[model samples]
Target: MPKLIEMMKPWQWMLYIFFWALFVTSIDRHDLATWPQFFVKFLSRIVQYTLSIIPSLYLIDYLRPIFKRDNPINVSMKILLLFAITSAVSATLVMLVMINTGWLVYERKAFVLNVLFNIVITVGFTLVFMLYFIRRYRELIALKQSFEHKLTAQNDLIKARIAPHFFFNTVNSLVSLIESNPPKAADLLQHVSALFRATFDGAREISFEEEVELCEHYLAIESSRLGDKLVVNWNLPDDDVMYDMVITALTLQSVLEKMLLNVVEMTTETIFIDITIEWHQHRVTITVTVQLPSKTLMIVHDLRRHVNFYIQAERLRAYFDQSADIQSDVTNEQIVTVINYPLYDVSI
Candidate 1:
C-alpha cells in the first residue's frame, strides 16, 4: 500500500479518488434527499471504496514479481482477472451491508446488475492507469539513454584531445632525453609505449588509484627530462575514500600534464608543483598548485585558456551528470587548478 502511494503522482491520486467518488455517487444518487443524507452517503461510500481498493491494490503489488515473469499480454490478462475477482468479492460484501442497512433492495436482478457494474468500473480504472504508467516509464527510459549517448560522444572528443596533447609533449621530452641521456630515452620509450597501450584499451572510466599512477609515470618521464628544474610533490590521503571511486579516464593525467607544461613554458627557473588529493563529503578533490615567478603573471590567461580547452572541463561535467567541478585561479605567486568530482563507488 505504501509502495502504491509512492508510485502514484499527485494528479494520479486525485484522479483515483475522484473516480471512486463518482462511482459511489452514481450508485447512491436516488438516496440523496437532503444535505445531511448526501453527506452521510458520500462519507460512507468513501470508506467503503477505501476498504475495497486498498486490498486489491495490495494484492496487485504482491503479485507483481510473478506477473513480470510472464509476457505483456499474459500479464495484462492476469491483472484483469485479479481485478475482476477482487471487485466481485468487494461488491458482494457492499451489497450485503447495503441490504442489511435498508439502503438497497433484496432483489436478485438488482444485486446481479450492481456486481457487474462494480467489476466493469474497477477493471477499467486498473487498465487505464497501468497503460498510462507504462507509457511514461518508457518515455523516461528513452530520454535517459539519449542523454547518456550525447555524454559519451563528448567524452570521446575530450579523450581524443588528451591523447595527442600528452603524446606530443612526451615525444618532445624523448627528443631532449635522446640528446642528453640515450639510456633514459630508451626507458622512457618503453614507459610511453605501455601508457599508449593502456590508453587505447577503450576504457571510459578508471579507478582513482590507476589514474594517479598514470600521472606519476607521465611526471616521471617529464622529470627525467627537466631534472632539478621541476619539483613534484604528492599529498594523497591514506584513507580508503578513493579506493573504489572511478572517474573518466585520463582526467587527472591531462590536467597535471597541461599545468606542468604551461609552467615549464612560462619559466626557465626551478618550479615547485604540488599535487594534493583529499576526500570530502563523498567528493574527491585534486588540487595542483604551481609556484610561478612574478615576471610570468601575464601568462595566467593563456594557461587558463589552454587548460580549459585541452581538459574539456565542461565535457567532464556533462559526463559525470553535472557532479564534476573544475576551476582555476592564478595569483602572482602561484597557479592553482582544482578539480572536484563525486566519488562514484562501483562496488556499491
Candidate 2:
C-alpha cells in the first residue's frame, strides 16, 4: 500500500480499490442466487471501498514511517491501528446500509453479532489486499526504475557519440560548402540544429510526425556526409494517419543510426536503407531493411547492442503493453528489422 502510493495515478488507485473490493465482495457472499441480492451488496461494497479506502490511503501514507519499523511492538501497534481505522469505517458504512436496506430491523443480539463478524471479515480482507498491493507496487517500481535507467544510459551514450561520429564530419562539410554552396550549407546548419534538439530531448513519447521530422533531419545530415554512397527509401502510409500515432522519441531513428553505423564497408554500388510502414488490424508494423555490406566488414558486432533488441521491445511494451514487439531477421544480404505496436483507436 505504501509503495502503491508512490507510483499510482489517482484514477489507477481508484481502479485498484474498485476491483479489489468487487473481488472480495464477490467471494465473501454465500447466497449468490439472485441479481437483486448480488447488486445491493455490490453497490454497497463499491461505495464502502470508494469511501473507506480513500481516507485510509491518506492515513496509511502519513503513518508509513511507523509502519516500516522492524520492532515487533511497533509492528503490532501499526497493524492494530490500521485495522481499527479500516474496521471502524467499514462498520459505520455497513450500519448505514443496514438501516436503509431494513437489515437493522432483525433481532437485536443477532444483528450485533452479524455486524461484528462482518467487520472482522471485511477488515481481514483489507489487510490481505494491502499485502498484495504492496508486493505488486514494489515490482512496478523496480521495472520503472530499470526502464528509466536504461533511457538515461542510452541518452548519455548518444551524447558521447555525437561529437566523434557526426559533428566533426558535419563541421568539415559546412566549411567546404560555406564558400562553394552557401544555401546547401545553410540547409545543413538547419538539419544540424534539429539533430541536436532531438538528441538532447528527454526520454518521452512524441507524435510520429515529430519522430519522422527528426529522422528526416538525421537522414539529410547523414546524406550530406555520406554523399551518393547512402540511399534511403521510405514507403509509408498517409500523412494524416502517420501524424496521429505516437512512439518513443528517437527510437526508430536509433535503429536507423545503428543500421548505418554497423556498415563498415559497402559491398554493393550504394548502401540502401529501406523503411516501410504499414497498418493492419489495430497495430502498425514498421520494417527496416538495410542492404548488407561486405561479409568481412559486416562480420563486426551489431551497433544496436547499445539499445539492444530487448530494450527496444520493452520500450514498445511501455507504450502498447504486451501487444508490442521488436524483432529482426538476418539473411545473407540484408538485416530486416520489424517493429509492431498497437495503435489506440483515438490515436488514429
Candidate 3:
C-alpha cells in the first residue's frame, strides 16, 4: 500500500458512511424524526455496507498481484476466472439485498434504475481508483528508471576514466621507444598525441561517417605500434543516412578496444575487423566482426571489471524502454557483435 492510500483511510470510511446516508435518504424521501431516521438508515444499510467489503477485497487482491508477479495472467487462468465469477456473484447478491431490504423498492422500472445507479457508482469508484493507482505505478516506474540512469552514468564515467588510463599506459610503454628509436618514436608520439586529443574531446555520438574517421585515427595510432598486423574492412551504406541518434561518447572506441584486447597480435600475422552500418526501415544497425581468440571469448566478463555491465544494461533498458542485447553469432565462420538502435526522422 502507498502512503497516499494510508492517508485516505479516514476519508474512505467517511465516504462509506456518506454513501450509506445517501442510500437511506433516497428510500425515505422525507426528513427523519431525529434518532429514528438516523438509526433506521444505519441499520437498513448493513447489507449495502457489507456489500462494499467483498468487492474492495476482490479489487485489492486482483491488483496487488500485478506488482509481485512477472508471468502472464493467463498462466493463472483458473484463479483469475474464479475471481471474476465470484465478483459477479457477490454483485448480484448485493443487488438482491438492496432490493429485498426496502432500500429501494423493485418496480420493474425502479429495479432498472437502481441497476443503472449501481453501475454509475461502480464506474465512478473505478475511475477514482484508476487515477490514484496509475499515478503511483508511473511514479514507481520513473524511480526505477532514474535509479538505472544514475547507474549507467556512473558506469560510463568509469569507462571514460579507464580510457584515459589505458592511453597513458600505452604512452608510457612508448617512452622506451622515444629514448631508443629517436625519429621513429617522435613521429609515433606525435600521431598518438594527436589521436588521443581527438578522442578525448570528441562528442558522445557522431555520424557513421564521422565515426569511421575517428576509427581511422584510432587505427593509425594502433598501427604505429603493431604495424602490418591490423586490417579494417568497412562495408557502409551510401544512402543519405544520418547518424542523428544519440549515443554515448567513445562507444565504438570501447567496443573496438575490447575487441583489440582479446585478439592476439603479431608483426607477421594480421587480424581483420569488419565494421558495417546500414539502416532498415526505422532501425539502424552497426555490426562489427572480429575473430575471437581460441582459448576463451567473453567480453562481458572483462567489461564487468571496471564499469558495472549489468547496471549499464539496465540503464539502457530504462532509457529506450527496450533491451540492448549482445550475442555471439557464429555465422559463415565469423563472430559478430550487432548494435541496433532505432532511427528517427531528424525533422522531428
- lDDT of all predictions, in order shown? 0.72, 0.73, 0.56
**Please, what are the lDDT tens digits per residue for candidate 2 over residues 1-348?**
334356568889778767766786687677557777677767766776666666666777777776676674666457546655676667566766777778445566755665566567656766776577657868878988897888777667656766686778789989989999999999999999987887787667888888888999988987886777788899988987786778887778878877766662234357888999887787888899988765345542453443246656776777566878888777667788998998875743
Ranking by lDDT: 2, 1, 3
TM-score of each: 0.62, 0.60, 0.47
Identify the leading candidate in terms of TM-score: 1
Q: lDDT tens digits, residues 120-174, model 3?
A: 5544554565576658868887887676567556555645754775677568647
**Which should have the higher lDDT, number 1 or number 3?**
1
Report how far residue 48 has shifted in candidate 3, in Å: 35
Quote the lDDT for 328 in model 3.
44
Off by over 4 Å in 3: 1-165, 173-210, 243-245, 266-268, 292-318, 330-333
Question: What is the Cα-based TM-score of model 2?
Answer: 0.60
Tell me how far candidate 3 lies from the true structure as C-alpha RMSD in angstroms.
Answer: 14.3
Pairs in steric clash, model 3 = none
| Weakest lDDT window of 10 consecutive positions for candidate 3 | 303-312
Candidate 2 has its poorest 10 consecutive residues by lDDT at: 299-308
Best by lDDT: 2
lDDT of 2 at 117: 63
